[model samples]
Target chain A: MHVMIIGAVGMLGKKLASVIAKTRQCNGQSVTRLTLVDIAVAETPENPAFPIESLAFDLSHTDTAPLLTKRRPDIIFHLAAIVSGEAENDFEKGYAINLDGTRHLFEAIRRERDRNGNAADYRPRVVFTSSIAVFGGPYPDTISDTFFRTPQTSYGTQKAIGELLLEDYTRRGFMDGVGLRLPTICIRPGLPNKAASGFFSSILREPLVGQPATLPVEDTVRHWHASPRAAVRFLLHAGTMDSSRLGHRRTLNMPGLSATVAEQVEALRTVAGNDAIALIRREPNPDIAAIIAAWPQDFTADRATDLGFRAERSFEDIIAVHIEDELGATSA
Target chain B: MHVMIIGAVGMLGKKLASVIAKTRQCNGQSVTRLTLVDIAVAETPENPAFPIESLAFDLSHTDTAPLLTKRRPDIIFHLAAIVSGEAENDFEKGYAINLDGTRHLFEAIRRERDRNGNAADYRPRVVFTSSIAVFGGPYPDTISDTFFRTPQTSYGTQKAIGELLLEDYTRRGFMDGVGLRLPTICIRPGLPNKAASGFFSSILREPLVGQPATLPVEDTVRHWHASPRAAVRFLLHAGTMDSSRLGHRRTLNMPGLSATVAEQVEALRTVAGNDAIALIRREPNPDIAAIIAAWPQDFTADRATDLGFRAERSFEDIIAVHIEDELGATSA
Candidate 1:
């Protein structure tokens, strides 16, 4: 089957492409063609078993979505979005890319599906990478799958809107859509982006690699997380999962380990020894702290667990995965 | 202060205009001008106390929003939308009017607010009419203020998206926005439109007027409602309320009477006698029944009540209001 990944130049997207190329199959069907897209130019992974097409395309532009749709990939992974801080700072750009871009892609697919009056025949499996940011606080300790999405930021609002459109479009039979609400990726494998949640990874990622990193919030501040490897697995599983299982609500909260900053530090100490933990510096930025305060701490993602999507059981396991994936044997 | 009503010719919009004109003030401010616009030609209210301008315009059109923004009405009542059943059947038109049309208005407001670098001064009070359809079922008997919105229909999706935009736009200080999640308007004073919930009104409306009406579902099916008068009052209240108290979430579930179809019939019988009750014929429509089954039945509208938005407490009260307002002494 042909598979397409938009935002395929990003860390998780690259990991997902490499994993699929290595595995050669999804849900027991061989992936015969891979189309990778991003605003940044994507380089084709070496020694892939399938035919590959890499393209740099801005989804917000009018022509790109239709061009992608013309390929008619059987499976589509849509992961492109502006980060939370960027979205908050540049309001118009945020809505233009995150909201309008997603809508354009969905519309393109929908128009293609309706072209022949055989919508059912042409419907593709769409796995949308949503975020836990979709849920804002005044929240319970563990936000359940059914909790209200009153997103506090423009990014969250955009994601929530995308989820709604995905559900609606799926209901209309234009696509088989599954929105996986991913947790903040801890020990992310690259340089930090402008996301408010970046500190969650940086405080762990930098310190463990013998470099000092700043902690913006107090130790009591809790958050949900999955490793980059786990996030890729989530995308793959969502692409393969039974759409019938989702019913009316297309989005499911992916499972993650909930840990306070103290817990994360302890996990880091366990995995990388006391020297690694000592590399962490305490610095408080109230702007970032205030943004983090309104974020959801934990989630009871029982729905995703029930559907067989897995994540690291503890922050130690999350750190171990990151070390193996990014640092390998050279780590402390 | 000038006020604009985008759906000025619709039942709610027309009633709202006449009510405001009769009072000649909104939230204690004298109304100097009224702009009434609709896709159909909007006739200026007879002997309007304020200087009233009526125009035929489609909100979905590209240029209409910019034109409307040029006037910069101090209070904008955006009550325009394609109803649910129509939205479900005609997908493109639903999105064009409900989603894109709403976005255009919001963008226009945002642009005009930013035009002079004095967004705070240009910020207008925008009262948006949302609906209970925003909440799809798997609901609690009394859905609280913070319940998730998982709308099953296209119309509900559109409204949910609108609410998100309203909140974000308000947050950014472009507009002072309030979204009122109105109940199904019981005994709507008009010929039935294509809405699936139309029977909620028709069953009561036709019976009270000594005309036959069909009940499409079982008598045990429960629903939430407010009278047309109460709905108008809710709109006006939303327009005038202390927006500072709204916090970050701009929308509130307006209080309404929750009653079973059996209870509604009982109320109808109390108001118009057994002969009137005899006018309702049971006609089961599986499609509509399925749709209604997925709808929210009740809500704990504590937030709205505390905010001073009120509705009828009993189905009989709703019927009485309909009689006094629509039927009067001429009804059988």
Candidate 2:
């Protein structure tokens, strides 16, 4: 089957492409072609593999829909979005890319299918990567998959709106859509991010690099999380799932460990020893405190789990994912 | 306290204005001034009890925010909306009025407060009239206030987005916002509407005027609703309640009666008797049937009751409201 990744260059995007490119079998099965797409120029990987097409073009322009319709891959991995902090900072740009760009994709595919009339059985499965940020303040118990999404940030608000549109369009028979509400990715690769949750991964990634990391939040602060590897797995699984089983509730909250900052410190000590823990600095930021307070500390992802969606079982496993996948190390 | 009603010319808007204007008290307390806002040209009612201002200018225009800040009323009944049926037909206009216009009001209030700092002391309670359209597709036993809002229509989508912004802005202390998810307004005044659910009101309303009316669905199809009087009471209650008591989670499922179309028909007979029933035409429009099929049948509005919000005791009261309010008859 032909697979396409809209944002095939970002952290999870790259991981997804690499995983699908190699693992010729999943629970024992054969793989085929992979198509990668993004606004920026993407490079074709080396070695013999399925035919590759790299496109460096803006998807927000009005006509991008026609182009995507032309590409018509069987499975679509839509992982691109305006990050939270940046989206909040640049409101117009964020809405343009996140809201407008997403609509363009759905509309394009919708037009194609409308013309095709479902006779050829040619509808592609589109997996949308959503976030826990979709849920907001005054949470009751653990936020169930059915919790009303009252996003606090502009980014969260945009994503929640996106989820609504996806469901509406899908209900109208536009495409086979599945939105996965991913937990905050822990032990993220690359430089420390300006994201409020970046410190979660930074404390691990930075110390592993023999550098000091600042812990902005307190030890008792708990949050939802999964690893980049797990995120990729979720995308793959969503791509392969049967749409009939999903019914109308196309969005699912993926699993994650609900651990506090203190727990993360403990896991870090176990991973890189107490010396690395000693390298961590304490600091306080009230702006972040307000944002963190609105977030759900955990979720009861009964729906996603029942659907076979999975995530890291422990913070240590999350830390290890970074070491093996990103830190140039084989299985320990 | 000073109160303002936007979109005062619409059916419910005008009814709410009249109720509040004639009131000796709102939420059992005296109200001082009432401002009625709309884009259409309107004249100040000669018999307006308290201070009343009727303005005729587009609230969706660029300059509305500053103009509103200058007026700066203490309590705002933000009943302004593009309306469901109209919004669904015109996408761009729906977004501009329903979404951008709301943002403009909030931003205007924010800027006004920013200029005066805490000394502004000008924060007003805002009551947003949301709709049951916020809940779509997934039919369950009873929709809790905790149920996720997965709107099916573009209009519902806009309202859901508005509720999110209202919650976040209220939480930020820029405003105190309360959103009431009203069920379908039954016994609506004037000519029949193209709205999918318009048949609910048309069946009774048109027949009362000695005209034939159409019934769209089976009597067994149930939905939630409050009488016009109950809806106005909800607005007044929301405006006067102590919002600090609410803390966060400002949006609420306004109390309503869960009645079937058959019960409504029975209520019509109870009021107008056999003559009113004979004027009803038995016909179902497929387009409306498609839309109504996905609508929620009932909601467990336990939260609203606890908050002191009220709805009609029965469908009998709803039909009686139409007689007492619209037909100018105290006794049917």
Cα RMSD of all models vs. native, in order, equals 1.8, 4.9
C-alpha DockQ of every model: 0.89, 0.46
- In model 1, what are the clashing residue pairs, if there are any? none
lDDT tens string, model 2, A248-313? 678899998889999888988887898999889988888777677777899899988998988888
| Native contacts kept (model 2) | 0.62
TM-score between model 2 and native: 0.80
Error of 1 at B60 (Å): 0.8
**Where does model 2 exceed 4 Å of error?**
A1-9, A17-77, A86-126, A193-195, A206-222, A259-294, B1-4, B20-76, B80-97, B100-125, B192-196, B202-218, B261-293
Across A1-332, the per-residue lDDT of candidate 1 in tens digits comes to: 99999999888888888888888876567899999999987888787777999988999997889899889999999999898888999998999899999999999999888777866678899999989888777999888888898888899999999999999999988889999999988888788666778888998889876888888889999988889888888888898888798889999999998999999999888888899888888898899899889888898999999999999999888888887888875334
Instruction: Provide the TM-score for each candidate, comma-separated.
Output: 0.97, 0.80
Model 1 C-alpha lDDT per residue in residues B55-107, reported as the tens digit of each score: 78888987889899889899999999999888998999999999999999999
Candidate 2: pairs in clash: none
